[model samples]
Target: MADQEETHTNGSGDNQDSPATAKKSGRTSLLDSGEDFEVLDDVDEDVDDDLPPLEDAGGHKKKSSGEEESAQAEGANVTELSAPQEEWLDVLGNGLLKKKVLEPGSGPDSKPQRGQNVTVRLRSSLADGTVVEEEPNLSFTLGDGDVIQALDLTVQLMETGEKALVETDAKYAYGALGSVTPAVPPDTALTLELELLSASDAPDLELMSPAERIQLASQKRERGNVYYQRGDYAFAVNSYSIALQITEASSKVDISPQEEEELLDVKVKCLNNMAAAQLKLDHYDAALRSCVSVLAHQPDNIKALFRKGKVLALQGEYAEAIRILKRALKLEPSSKTIHAELSKLVKKHSEQKGAEQAMYKKMLGNPADSSAQKRQAKTSWGVSWKWLFGATAVAIGGVALSVVIAARN
Candidate 1:
């Protein structure tokens, strides 16, 4: 579900009026102003032909004996930790909260691993018994950000049929900014009851054909979109990245040119979306890189250009921002979103220019005063040095005359 776009008047979010905002107040965003993506013409999809083959679920193909021995040695270097005998465990390594298993079940083997979808029945509320959210069934891949970080960590530590109450501070639950729905207000502590229904491994990527990979990538893209709409930028980034990884991997597999084009298109969309998430996280450099990648394939991509311009604007490179945004406006003349953003940049540029002029004037002051001060300092230094030299010469002459008079006597 896409989060309904809302105008924020509280001045407590990203400064830019883009569709998305960062977790903190007064940052910039790369999310486009609610527009469809501009499709690009086909490009060469075999860009990464030199990369190594991805490992299958079983394992990588056999290499030379030396390489195999080396891999074995590296594996030997790894030491696995014994399962925790202590009842309480901290999942994220930070001391946010301690998870003590309410009822222990079948151990590690029964637990779900990363990339496996886990289904759970969730009931959440404030410490004061105010219900925030409840769902009879909710499913999310482990290690994915579909659920809150703490909950994701907690469930992975439990087995099927196990139920646990995870207590977390407001920081881990909602942080400073609340959810899009305002159901979980900012900085509100939460108690969640999670009943693990089942866990199953997702389809193996390496075993899948090119078509299957494309389908999976699309699914992940949709999931990412849902997360983006909810204003969960971090989760959204994760989903997009997974989708991108799948698309790239699909491109590597033996596929026809048409299939490659479709995968590349999906890849481009993922990059664009991931850029938006990066913007909301205040990751300007990453967002710019994504835009750069998109533009490499599609120069006329309005979203890419607009996002790039936005990133430049946030970085205070108003001149470049204006140039890029103007180019985008040419591509989309009637787009109020682009037009509005361009106006903002132009206004920002004017303000910046005025500020620079004021600062220069303040430093230089009246031209006459500046020149007078410079001349006065120069004159004083020059006169002082001359007088010191003259005094030394006179003293030397006096000493020479005294010596001559003593010799004559």
Candidate 2:
């Protein structure tokens, strides 16, 4: 259900506009403007090949390890085997969730942890066996809310290569507002046939190929977009943060020039989108950092500059805000959005300066009194200069008279 949420992609062009502009224009956000990465095509193709074929509801046919080894040693094709007896276990003890193990998994002790990434094949159906959803290989991090609550909880109880039929109450599945894609009615119970293909800890970016890193990062960004559209700003921020981490770490891996460019683009998108989400949450400092990260990569990115300016203005750093908005305007001179934002920022900056000046005048007593004191000081200086000039003129006149008397004698 989480994966089925709507996703908005970030666009390629710098003129696409920021989320603030989108809001003014009655558009959703900058996330709504771009092409999404085709991530489904990057999923591992060998997930189905590793699993044994599904058996009928009666049970699955099995072979002992020793028998399999012996048959392999003899070069004999072992096809038919005795069927394992069916057994259903109450997963939650409340019977709201139950699991029927069709085939036992290998490495029984290595079950998936809560945060581990798990890939599984699932077929979800209604009580009457109407298939609502079928995924050949769905990979998601456990406890990450990538899937429904029922699937997340059920997967943690299964191991690699395990195939089980899970029964879940509506409370654990889609609840009242059942899924729209599969058209599940309200309060419907789901019967899921799940095959846990593989479960592992989250991949370390340094060890992954460049393409893999980009794919994973793009998926995280896409998930963030979904969360953003759903107004889950906190989760959206978390997803974007993870994507940023992946992209940042990918720099250390050996990658082609083209891959490097793509990685940087993804990084910029994540940062810009993260800034938007953080702004929604009122995490001004974090949002400012995100925008700064984007600008560090692409200085002329109009969205980052716009968002950074907005964040700075929100934090009352109006001078820097004005500078950033002006920079963004220089990049996209004709952008009405940038123009409008710069206008607002300039006005706000002026008003803010005016308020500060007023506050200082109030702190220092009446500004009118200060002006009068300055005027009085200027008048006193003027009078002192006038008196000195008059004294000099009188002295010079007396000296001239004395000289004239001496000449007459």
Candidate 3:
């Protein structure tokens, strides 16, 4: 699965709210653009720690530096905490939030742009020194709203390998509503210790050379394969699609004949793999399109043909599926994959035929069995002529007796 930004609160405060605490009420606002916020009465009373002691919400205590290394030596999961060393500086011109850089980063020499994916490890806490979130690692694009506005803005000022402590007032933290996590109270400030692990620009096919583009596409395809193996079919589809796009873009570039051929081959493989992943995701139309793209380049590609046939079968186009699978089988007569798919299509066709026939019989009452079935049904219900004839004889005898009595009277 693609690494998603997870909200984790660090410290002893990452659990249920203590009964001694009072819930704050007011309009909560994220600390963005130096926005003004209403001050809550409980901010001082609830914040008890002079310099907050970091705790693990994962039910583990914060270990000493030496103990942490020793535990790591024994193969234990160790949570590393960064100590605050520098005074905080206002992030914006206003003093709504502050940042303290622990270590300067080296990178493109500039901060990240919005929409660029940023990978980082971070720990978040309240101003009173209670850890609210401590994530070992997470990946999120700037301006995506996947992370809180405070951290999102803070990352914009960060470079790869930079570690910094960011402090946001209650206005910027969870505002009044707090976060989805119940551990975060309303009108709480948040402090974050963040380390930028990596920053990457979006994939641009136009600027990359044919070789570079091909290599990049191959990387995407590899990433997709990993996602596919992890049962993340949707992400796998996306990864393969990125590769396909990269190759498609590379086709327009001025390149040698060999490179062009390589690009085409890569594109074909990407399309095929994308179709396979789409099939797993039940994206029938998309999978079919990928297969069609593959077939456009290599009409005799057995994988594409088989994938197309499977997609058709999933859509209940059994006849078309059979035709396509047969074509594939003829190209590679010994392919077990094609043979199995063909068998499945044939079985589906037979089952569909049987179901249709059964439905027709039910709706139209089976003309072939009409007369005999009617007779059998009558016999089963004792509605035969013999029963009618016996009733008629009894009625006649009753009528004759009644007439005789009336005449005697």
Which model scores highest in TM-score? 2
TM-score of model 3 vs. true structure:
0.50
- TM-score rank order: 2, 1, 3
lDDT, candidate 1, 1-409, per-residue tens: 0111212221212212222333343233323222111222332333322233343224756699999899789889678744434345554555665565566555556877777988988888988998888888888878765556667667766778877778887655665556654388887778888888899987667777888988777767766765665576776777889888888763334788998888888788788777777887789999999999989988987778888999999999999999999998999797677788889889989999999988887887767778999999999999999999999999999999999999999
TM-score of 2: 0.60
Range of the 10 consecutive residues with the lowest summed lDDT in candidate 2: 1-10
lDDT of each candidate versus the true structure:
0.71, 0.73, 0.67
Q: Candidate 1 vs. truth: CA RMSD?
A: 19.4
Q: In order, how many clashes per candidate? A: 0, 2, 8
Q: In model 3, how large is the Cα lDDT of residue 61?
A: 67
Question: lDDT per residue, candidate 2, 1-409, as tens digits?
Answer: 0111112223321112222233354233332222121112222323332234365434745789998888788766656666555656665667888777777787546678777999999999999989999999999988665666688777876778989989999867766656576678888999999999988898777889899988888777776765566455676777778888888883456789999888887787778777777777788998888878777877877777888888888888889889988888888797777787779788887888899899988998977898999999999999999999999999999999999999999
- Best candidate, lDDT: 2
Deviating ranges (above 4 Å) for candidate 1: 1-98, 121-138, 174-190, 195-200, 209-215, 222-232, 251-265, 315-319, 343-409
lDDT of 1 at 390: 99
- The digit string of per-residue lDDT tens for model 3 on 1-409 reads 0110111111210111111221332111101022222222222323322243454225576799999888789766556666544556566657977777788787446567776878899888766788767788788656543456678777877768988888887666666656545268878877789999888886556867889887776666655554444344565666667667778773445799998888887677667767766766678999899889888898987777877888898898999999998998999797666777788779889999999999999899787699899888888768667788899999999999999999999
Q: Root-mean-square deviation of each candidate, in angstroms? A: 19.4, 15.5, 20.2
Could you tell me which residue pairs clash in candidate 1? none
